[model samples]
Target: MAYVFLAVAIVSEVLATVSLKLSEGFSRLGPSVLVCVGYAVAFVMLSQALVRGLGVSLAYGTWSAAGVALVALIGAGFLGERLSGIQIGGIVLVIGGVLALELGAEHGP
Candidate 1:
């Protein structure tokens, strides 16, 4: 299903981003390799979702919003990164915008 592909894409993207941080400017071998592979998987799954009839706006919006939120949370929780109140609010707005896009699509033009 398109949704399944999208979900995989989101997760893969998040993992890739996290691996990117852990890669230390590509100085680290394992995480660096993971970064490359994860992003490859993410994009492949995203394209598959698009090919399966997911609208571009909806799919990209969801993918980007989810990736941003998840990466932020993971960074804060596991990577000793901090999130200001403003940044958290921004993430909420991004997610809300994606939800609106999805709902608006369902209602048609």
Candidate 2:
């Protein structure tokens, strides 16, 4: 379904972004390939989700916010990037807001 594609888009994008770090500024081969393929897959799936039935605001907002949080986590936990307490709180708020929107989403149009 559209939601399935949306989920795929999010996961692929997160993987691609994380691989970006491992790509070493695109100097490496394996991670570089992953970055390219993952981004391609992500956009493709996002388009498919739109065509299928998802709302534009719902899908786009969730995708953008989730991608940011996932990327931050990957950098902080895996890449040793520092995450301040305030930033962590903001991330949690973003996630909660997204979930609330999804759960209480309006359907008309």
Candidate 3:
């Protein structure tokens, strides 16, 4: 499953992004290392998903949108970041767009 790999890629990417914030401009050793390693895993898994026949448009759209939403949520929940109502709406739009992409892909030629 390419979907499985995609999920891994999404999770790894989210983790890497969160770790980047924790890394404090790469001044912190542990989270900095995690940021580097997590991104590596994310890219490798994403490449595997692409190689396994996932369309580039669909895969990248879904991956990037989902990562953005997840990172925003994590930041708000754990990092005391404030999300305005407009930002929340934007996240909803991103998710809706990803779902539309998936649905369209299923009906695509």
Candidate 4:
């Protein structure tokens, strides 16, 4: 299903972004390779989702919003990073906006 592909794309992108941080400016070999491979697979999956009739706006909004939120959480929880209250609020807003987009699409005229 299109949604399945989109979910894969989102998770792949999130992992790739986290791998990017772990790559240490590409100085580390394993994570660096993961970064490249993850992103490549992410793009391919995203294209499959689009080709399967997932709307561009909805797909991209969900993908980007989820990616940002997941990456931030991973950074904070595992990478010793901190997020200010405002940043947390921003993440909530981004996710909310994506939800709005999806709901709007579902109930469109």
Model 4: how far is 73 from its true place, Å? 0.6
The Cα RMSD of model 4 versus the native structure comes to: 1.1
Kindly list the per-residue Cα lDDT of model 1 for residues 26-107, writing each as its tens digit: 9999999999999999999999999999999999999999999999999999999999999999999999999999999899
Best by TM-score: 1
Among residues 3 or more apart in sequence or in different chains, the pairs in candidate 4 whose N, CA or C atoms overlap within 3 Å are none
Error of 4 at 82 (Å): 0.3
> RMSDs, each prediction?
0.9, 2.4, 1.2, 1.1
Give the lDDT of residue 3 in candidate 4.
91
Winner by lDDT between candidate 2 and candidate 1:
1
Per-candidate clashes, comma-separated: 0, 0, 0, 0
Tens digit of per-residue lDDT, candidate 2, span 10-106: 9999999999989999999999999999999999999999999887778887898899898998899889999999999999998888777777775
For candidate 4, the per-residue lDDT at 48 reads 96
Ordering by TM-score: 1, 3, 4, 2
Question: For candidate 2, what is the lDDT?
Answer: 0.90
lDDT for position 31 in model 1:
96
Supply candidate 3's per-residue lDDT for 100: 90
State residue 48's C-alpha deviation in candidate 3, in Å.
Answer: 0.4
- Give the Cα lDDT of each candidate: 0.97, 0.90, 0.95, 0.94
* Total backbone collisions, model 3: 0
Q: Which candidate comes out best when scored by lDDT?
A: 1
